[model samples]
Target: MFIQSFLLLLAISFLSAGRVPRPEERIIGGQNIEIEQAPWQVSLQVNGEHICGGSIYSNDIIITAAHCLYEKERRLEAKDFLIRVGSSLWNSKGTLVKVAAIRSHENYNSTNFTKDIAVMRLSEPLNFTDKVKNIPLAERNPAPGTVAMVSGWGATSIYPKHSYPVHLQGVDVPILTVDQFSISAGSNGQTACYRDSGGPLVVAQQLVGVVSSGYKYCDGPTQFISVSDERSWLLNAIASIKL
Candidate 1:
């Protein structure tokens, strides 16, 4: 059964090349969340349209999937992107911040999404409040099978573009070992999906992973760039980039 599922996922992965998240990708079986539940969550938007999810790492730094910016080859200027923070819904009122710069891992390989991580420098420092704050980064990976919480504004189903959620959605999913996750298929309810690319995977409120890619629709397994594994790279980027 696993083999068959793997084959099917392989085909879908090929069909959906490039790490772009399709509209069909979303939170398959998640529940709506309260507005201030995740103060660090941010919605990444391009041309004013909600595209991917992200998380605030500091007053001026946000972490997300590299594909969120690299899907297009052209260099992105700070003006081309906007980040919505302090809101439960993607389109609802929030603190809109402009991008000052975007830096993706130098070794980011789009073909297989290796090192698929990126950080954005906000144009200005965000004022911290109960509804807007940064989340701590995980110092190490949690043990396998640990339950992690993932939240996002992706669609609620695999069907056509379900209107963007008016409220954020969240789900608790168990962490699968690298071996088990590597062979897994698309999201199966509790996993991240296309709309969730660049979303944060948190364990005990510490950011541990960044959503990279998932199945074509929304089921089975999802892949995340482990934040703990790339801690050095992230710290270097954060330090090198001046506010």
Candidate 2:
């Protein structure tokens, strides 16, 4: 059971992109890029409060971190969550989709930070707009050193008293080899920070990964979940839920 759970968590981690270390150089020039143009971008809310980030892969489905829904003593239900698509700021009025079902990877072990992926089904289909559209999934394998982008509403600087950014933040990062990331991230460090999970990692207009986990310091280049690595699993999961 332990092994199964670990593997499940690893799968989720792969789906969610947890545990990225901050890069030494900060990206400051592209702050004006509009997030509204990214159709998959989503803001995750719990009990009517925006707490995290996610992305829409389909008209009725959104993906996010398993840890986002898991409390220390209890697991969250679909009824308690909502997804807002096409919103740049959390306070913006947008289409609110209530979660109808939640499917967390079976092997998920929240404590281990592996297999941290979960999919939430919306109660209704979302209307597609320039601000909201589906991001194409990557069918080919991604190589190390691939250039990609990560966006979120996470803090911009690491200070005990620093204020978290209210607008979405984005950074361009290179995909490091898995072995390299594993060593740098430490054995137990395998998850992205607040408001980053389930965000899209786009490369050449293809959705290559999902923003999962990263260092909280915001000091190094961020890590991401490799979506290309688990295309089959994601497709199967999506099919299962759609049917």
Candidate 3:
């Protein structure tokens, strides 16, 4: 299972990079932002338990990682998941979007991470407000070397096991060229890890990547499933569904 998991990580690590900076050291001096701008950002819950994170694309449609929906032999059922949107804190009451349907990419083989994407349809339209709104879909492919932003209520550091952030923690990372990401990522290095699955990788305020897998420590080289890389299939899937 470990080797299978490693290969799965490697397949997604097709891109390469050089020695990357740690999350804290790469901070931008910008003011702390609220989760409203990226209203689609959400905390995924299974049986009222926080399992991972995700992003909302439409009133009912959400995009997340395939692996997040599958844990060991326990694949999640629609009824078992709930999406909490617009709050930086977990316990805060926010719009509860019950997943009505889940669609994993047809090519998504659990042993590989090449197509690690999934969509969740909500039972009803989320009430858009200052605290909740949808994230804009990618308008075009982001250029390589573009810096993107990722936020989650995960750990603040890679080590020293600490409590999860009360407010969402944000990080800015440059998009690694395909060659750079693939090489530097290796079998293990720096990448998104536990609790970050299905999170959004935002570029210019648009959804560009989905959090898939990362290194064990939760810091180093982060690996994200590129949204632009699977544009055609995503478009077709979105079009086929009724908002």
Candidate 4:
């Protein structure tokens, strides 16, 4: 009985922290980046609250994680969503826009979080400028050992009580693998907590990954949904949506 109780407690301890950590989990071990460096970054919000991160694809489209669209297994409507772009802060300084539509992969599985990518159309096109630009999607995944960066407004601390930096943060992660339709990074201790789900993983100015999952603790491997793996679906989803 004592052993059973101890094991349960241990599991709970491991499950705590990070907005998304674990199969569902988020970022840490990152530093503030110049806001101008992330013109394509966005904060995915739910009913006026910042919940996840995303990347701009064009004047009207954004890419994020499929898991960010649900609450208690109920998918949210377009009316319940908005995005903040062109700012380093998730709460303030970015232009806010309404979400017009969202399309996740048909085979997306909540249980294992497979095919965790989603594309969204904005109610209106963004007025592009130096502060707001689109990120190009990668046609191929980077090889293992390449350093990529991920950005988001997520926890900076690994503790149960998370420290969320007001400004955007980024961390350099070394790729561990890009196999079976996913990209995995971190665990050598020099990674940024993936930050909020749906943020961009960039390499050479191309969007190679979408923040997907990680362990509850920050000092473990982080998984991302490979943009290259879903390129066909992404292009189709983008083309089908009308602004």
Clashes of each: 8, 31, 18, 6
By TM-score, the best candidate is 4
Show the colliding residue pairs in model 1: 185-221, 186-219, 186-220, 186-221, 187-219, 187-220, 188-219, 188-220
lDDT of 2 at 210: 61
In TM-score terms, candidate 1 sits at 0.84
> lDDT tens string, model 4, 1-243?
001121232234434454343332235666788668878999888766677889999999999988778755478888888899989888898699999999888898765668988999999999998779999999999999999988888666644555567788888888999887799987634444424678889999999998877655555666789999899999999998762
User: Which is superior by lDDT, 1 or 2?
Assistant: 1
Estimate, for each residue in 36-140, the C-alpha lDDT of model 3 and write its tens digit.
655667888776666677887877788887877775557778888888887866557676778888878888766546687888888888877877767776746
Q: How high is each candidate's TM-score?
A: 0.84, 0.77, 0.78, 0.87
Residue range 121-152, candidate 2, lDDT tens digits:
88999888888887777776457666666666
Give candidate 2's TM-score: 0.77
Runs of candidate 4 exceeding 4 Å displacement? 1-26, 192-195
Error of 4 at 104 (Å): 0.8
Off by over 4 Å in 2: 1-32, 179-192
For model 3, what is the C-alpha lDDT against the true structure? 0.63
Query: Candidate 1: global Cα-lDDT?
Result: 0.73
